[model samples]
Target chain A: MTTDSLKYLWQFALLCLLQVLIFNHLNLGGYVNPFPYIYLILILPISIGRIQLLLVGFLLGLTVDVFSDTGGLHAAATTLMAFYRPLYLKAQSPREGYESAAVPHIKTFGFAWFLPYAALMVIIHHTALFYLEVFRFSEFFHTLLKTLLSSTLTLAFIFLAEYLFVSTRRRR
Target chain B: MRNVLLFIYRNHVFFVFLLLEFVCFWLIVRNNNFHRGSVLSSSNRLVGNVYELNNNVTEYFRLKTVNEELALENAALRSLLNESKYISSGRKGEVKDSVARQHYTYIPAKVVNNSTDRRNNYLTINRGILQGVEPEMAVLSSEGIVGIVKDVSKNYASVISVLHQNSSISAKLKDSGYIGSLVWDGRDPQVAQLMDIPNHVELAEGMLIQTSGFSSMFPAGINIGKVKEFHVDEGDNFHSIDVELLTNMSTVSMVYVVDNLMRMEQIELEEQAQTDDD
Candidate 1:
């Protein structure tokens, strides 16, 4: 248990650093800024408590916010994503259901299962984040285009990260 | 009461989520307001230090362009010196007129962190309150105006960039002297809108736009941009003008923070006049 907590802490710190130092600086085509730090929440143990998940998401977002100078925008978006995570998982679970100690990873769940799950999560998070940052409905379509572009880039990066880190031989 | 408690306990996750969202919303609204010093911003010591460290690594790659920009600005400043130009005046002995009295002082600062793609972009500078930096001071790159200081910490300050949605600067046409409010339209980083110039005023493509100095934040005649295109609406009396900003906000790494020496006196007198009228 101590090792598990320590690993998560390290992951959290690394994600925040990667986001602030690297990803935040990427402004591809002046529209897409891939934010893949929310992958921290995505890879948490499926059975983690909801309240704990929410708090973790909020803290992760706040860490990014502190460095990016975007006050609370990420926090709100990540929290909303966390709130829907369990529902999405339950709705998409197989007939046999997930293992008690299962984690959400491409290697653990296979690419087919992980793709839609990660896409949904990334889309929700990006939509909420972009809209909140813009803070108006007047440019709804423009914001939507930006959100979609960023979400696609973020999804691609998340998958790249998953493939790079999660060993393929460790299938559950 | 027991039933109510059970219901609340059963839905504690939703309630907690709502509470956290509310807190975040409050923070966003507060941060959107100008001049509200908040610790969560990048100007905070921990974040500022991290950005400074990152900048230290990336700055080497940009040193060539930065050096050229500095050299160009130095030449411009050198030309402004009294000794640079041959004065035709035969009887000049250190004229101490009020016009010669310095009304602005500049503090050079390094841009540690900056962004341009975001709708409300901000630049974080290494100089802060320790270096006499304060909120509402004007920031300028060597080429043109950059932003206004929004918050200051001990060793860093965050500037609300001219590209921001809430940013508006009083600007004028250099030739016509028609003043307008310069604002970013949240689309293009290089282009900003100059609003409220009357339709009858003669305008031309590539006309120079400059600071009007109506506000205490900036001095008169600071080059902002040049007119890219302008047209009046079918029934409107004002011409909607597009200005191509002179400063490339994306690559601006060195800046100066302007401290208006007469700002306090001007504001105080204006307030007194208002009170008298009331």
Candidate 2:
């Protein structure tokens, strides 16, 4: 495989490890958790075929499940997310693509395009993950309260982490 | 054929989104029972690591609060020591001084993993089956009852937090002896509802609720929470009371898992009663 693809894949694996090894255990009170690492899947290079990118997301999430011993919970949620990555891309089509060598960011994608994109993706992932984990709606409203509130916090943390660590080197 | 192929490609993204959402939605709709698994859970190993890291950063933040609680407990213990002095020093011959001491032991444990953000949450402690802890043991902090031990491993055990939506405990008015199931509404950690307590029992907003000694999980008279708000359902005989939990679930750190020395006997008797009823 190409060096760039390999590098990104390595990055994805390491991030998944961090998520499973570190962040998965932090239950910071009720419905408050920091999960910025999922952004690795979100801001991956666009050069890879869309379908392949989706598969990789699925596999990445499944690997998290394996380490956490959560069986297929993360796997099923992530595979479905892999299927939807393109739509996230499409909704941000107003910008076409970031005109830089660096990956998309709030700085690159701009406030207008990036906010909706991040919010939508995080919601989708959180919804999938929470529902799969619970696998029930007996307390339908209670579960929904958790899914939405936790997802919002996760998305915000993703924003903060991206802003702090990602150094976008745009030569153009 | 070209038009059909192009149509599929054009809508591929939407189809993927639909499939993923549907799958996740299905998972939520299916799961019903709440069982035990502290190891592989929301505060799973990965989440545990984050909590450990966060614990470092916030450890300082909690030091003051923990110290205050510790001081309070120490004061309480010292007074108990004073009161029990008569019992010990009085029994000079037949009973040893140590034997006269109260054996209500408490083991300190760290919450390596805990989750309050989920619908049903649990906390994993560093001490477990090996540390004299066991399933059905009552877990508590200096504040009050944390939960019941659901599962245990060599060095770890998961506690079903009292905040959990499905969590049910026998509670009563500390004064009146009126009993009910303490149930969480899953909306707020500070608020839970006590059910099955008859309206005839007098209750005020600040009334203290404590474990009723009905279950082996929690010891009798352990402070639980206080009545926050209460209402009598029209035509119904029971009082639905909102209790404000005493423990700050947001920042639980150290806890004590209590093993009742006579829990087996209590549980066995209760089990036999159920069997007889059947």
Candidate 3:
């Protein structure tokens, strides 16, 4: 296997472990369930094949769903997010376009670009997740509040992780 | 055939995503008919084992509170025993003991997984089919009604907590014997709604609500909640009643699954009577 694939595999293992073990138990006043598993989908290399990306999203989500006992809500939402990642990238393509080998991260693309992309992904994922879990239009506002709060908290935690552990040289 | 193959080859990725989503949506939304589709649920062996391990460690931190609850239950049981013995009408103690034992069976279980925040909250207990816990059996804490057992596996069982939107329990006012049904509005864990009471039933705040014994799952006189506040909608003959549930659902660690010994016989007789009426 190539070094990039090896790196992603390790990242996948660590993120899933952290998500199920540490983040699932955080509670956060019972509303904000910060799903850092989305990070795995976000940081995939831009040129990776669609089939691999979709499969990874499904497995990652199903793993978290198993640990959290949420059934398949995570799997459904994460797979949808993976399907939309390419469109989101195309919508906000840089003037020079993306390098085929580049990974999407705050440092790699600068904070301005990374922030909106992550926000859109979080919004889509959380909207699908909260609505599907509740599955009622009567609680629309309540579900919306959960979606917004959880997305914000997830983005905050992702930012903190990126800033703390990532090396500057990797961005270049 | 060539055209179809060409289209399939071009759109395989999209179709694959669609197929995976269909499988996931089925898993998430469909209620399992035979319990085989949900190997990842908390009632399964692998997931249940992990939660049991986690609970084994965290249960230590709750020892003080748990002990207090157990002590209170012990006191209540002791008083009940004394009352039964004193009220025996010239019957021998052995016969009275047998009669008391036949009424209800309690299987004590520890909750290994619980969630109160969701729209449909469920509790996973360490007891299952091995312990004779069955679906539709009522569960109760020392304080009050917890929920009803929804599913049972080999070594674990899942309960549909009173906090669930779909949960409804038959209950009545203790003093006047006016009957109604209790249901959760999915808003607060502490409060639930008591419905189907006529406007003239005379419900007041703080009135005690208990199980009516009309259902075989729960016995009569089990404390459910107290009437908090109530209102009657315009042009409606029924009052909407709010109840403050007695059980602190968030902190419940130990629960007793109540298996009605004569439930099958009762159901059989009821069904027979229905056929005769027809």
Best by lDDT: 1
Per-residue alpha-carbon lDDT of model 1 for B37-154, expressed as tens digits?
9999999998898889999999999999999999998999999997998868798685656568889999999999999988899999999999999999999988899999999999
lDDT of 3 by residue, B14-76 (tens): 899999899788878654332333567777787788779878988999999999999998988
Between candidates 1 and 3, the one scoring higher on DockQ is 1
- Provide the lDDT at A151 for model 2: 80
Best by DockQ: 1
The window of 10 residues in a row where model 2 chain A has the poorest summed lDDT is A94-103
What is model 2's interface RMSD?
5.7
Off by over 4 Å in 3: A1-31, A95-97, B32-37, B83-101, B271-278
lDDT of 2 by residue, A126-154 (tens): 78777656656786765677678778877
* Ten-residue region with minimum lDDT total, candidate 2 chain B: B24-33
Candidate 3: clashing pairs of residues: none
Docking class of 2: incorrect
What DockQ does every candidate get?
0.80, 0.22, 0.54
Ranking by DockQ: 1, 3, 2
**Per-residue lDDT of A51-152 in model 3, one digit per residue for the tens?**
888899999888777766677888999999998898888888878988877888887888988899888998999899889888889988978887898899
